[model samples]
Target: MDMATTESTASTMSLASVTLEVADPEATHRFLTAFGVETYVRLRASQAPSTGFRGFTLALTVSRPATVDGFLDAAVNAGATVLKAAAKTLWGYGGVVQAPDGTIWKVATSAKKDTGPATREIDEVVLLLGVEDMKAGKQFYVDRGLPVAKSFGGKYTEFAAGDSSPVKLALYKRRGLAKDVGVPAEGAGSHRIVLGSTAESFTDPDGFAWEASTSSARP
Candidate 1:
């Protein structure tokens, strides 16, 4: 991949992070840490602390604060459910939201700014597919001419397509992935996963559907 580029008038944006709720927070943290996030901080007490993500912070607490209520209202207006409300805590204010497909989001706010780095608005969407047969799916993508990045045994694999902006296309398989996304194992039919980009869809051998696209850039 070409890594060199000259700064131009056209603004460039890239994906910052894709947060997901897991059944086990500790395990999720460990997986992400091993997957390449350089730092991790567990929110605990009432004092606000800095998280590594830019423009975002995390706190641990029970009820919804006014600020969190406003945030929830915005999200609700946009069609999301308030899974949990933010409230004062030993650490700070925290809340949870349920996005489409049962995806849970943990939202927190703190007085400290831990803005780490400028994030590129997502250029592409990567759909991670969990399959009953990893080898077959891997071969399917390989035979289709998608570029393979790395394979963690037959358990995990990532691929890249030509539709590059910043985010690359990839797939992976793990136990309970389908359940986490609120889809049945047999319900992995072809469908679209929109991400403010060009829309593209693919169906793997195990009937698992994946989609990607580019849309309007985030402000």
Candidate 2:
């Protein structure tokens, strides 16, 4: 295959962290720590914390079906709510889980053809945002120097992240997203997601905040 661009030549947005506004940072901390998000926490600021499904996550792409099942099992033990049991899909084997903070996670094995044991659990993650306007939401990131890898008729769009990103990002229609999370569509606030960046902190069109990882950390 012809290499049009490398991760370097592709995009400039490499995520520094995936922040969530939550009801209990302590509970979130414990749940993520079990799954290996070494530095998850809540904000200690004059402003109150945000909670509920501001968005969700396209968590990891495992190597096999059993891996997805096993990882979800671990997530269940770690105070997660099973939104969907692991199973085979036209895309591949996948499932959904609600983290302690109500962050929905869609886990799948994209490399289903590869009959391998499995990669380490939670190898790669993608931040999935449910946007009121998918077109406007996608343009928001495109204007920020990020490129779109895939877009499906303003329904779903995936961004090609820079190499420094621990996980990629995507956007989906808010109503469709509620279905994916296996919950009724409800709640909106200042947004729980805080984008970890090296540049100046800001907010997205949907009110999600972006913070420089270094300056982002607060007690």
Candidate 3:
């Protein structure tokens, strides 16, 4: 069977894989921050003209609060920067960490009301991107051959959840994402993030980088 046929059982518009470019592919790949996310790091120099967020957050939804706290501590000890400490809120327990590769990870537990029990390591992750125009962004992705699993009120959108892989994807307004991290609406000169696919390389409406490749699989 062809690649599409193999991935058909996965979610619609599902990602074949996600790749991150770092100075050291071996080191970064060993620096596993979460599971269910496939990564390939290669030695690449600065291609962007400026330094700002390329536009995405690696969001991890764990099964329990302990997993949230444990992953936070483990990540920090592994050299990740603590952007936010785990706290109790309507969204359960969650915190943010900036991994060495400059990727922002939002780790959260949906226990709501309580920290819940300690749990195992993370085994699921979903990619969340920021777009300047939700309407236009949605249209852009939809036109790019990604099936829309859900798009509502222009506030949030998600691609078909890839069935075999736990690495799902979604998008939100860039401004809101910046605000969420207490950053400016517009970042500095260039972007730092690149989203990979199995076909071709292109830039999204907000300038996020995406390159097409041969095949994508969960590791």
- The candidate that wins on lDDT is 2
Residue 41, candidate 1: how far off, in angstroms? Answer: 32
Q: Report lDDT (CA) for all predictions.
A: 0.40, 0.68, 0.65
**Candidate 3, 152-180: lDDT as tens digits:** 65667777754434567788788777666
TM-scores of all predicted structures: 0.39, 0.80, 0.78
Instruction: Look at candidate 2 and give me any clashing residue pairs.
Output: 21-192
- Native-to-model Cα distance after best TM-score fit, residue 195 in candidate 3, in Å: 2.8
Q: 1-219, model 2: which lDDT tens digit per residue?
A: 223322212455556666666666666667776765544333432234445555555567777887787678778899889988877777788889887666677778865555767555566677777788987987777777777777777688777766655678878887788787677777655555577875667777777777777755442
Candidate numbers, best lDDT first, in rank order: 2, 3, 1
Model 1 lDDT per residue over 101-192, tens place: 23333444442232343221112234455566768877776655555666666656655434333334444453444443333344322221
Q: What is the lDDT of residue 115 in candidate 2?
A: 75
Q: Of the pair 1 and 2, which is ahead by lDDT?
A: 2
Candidate 2: segments with Cα more than 4 A from true spot: 1-14, 23-26, 39-52, 111-119
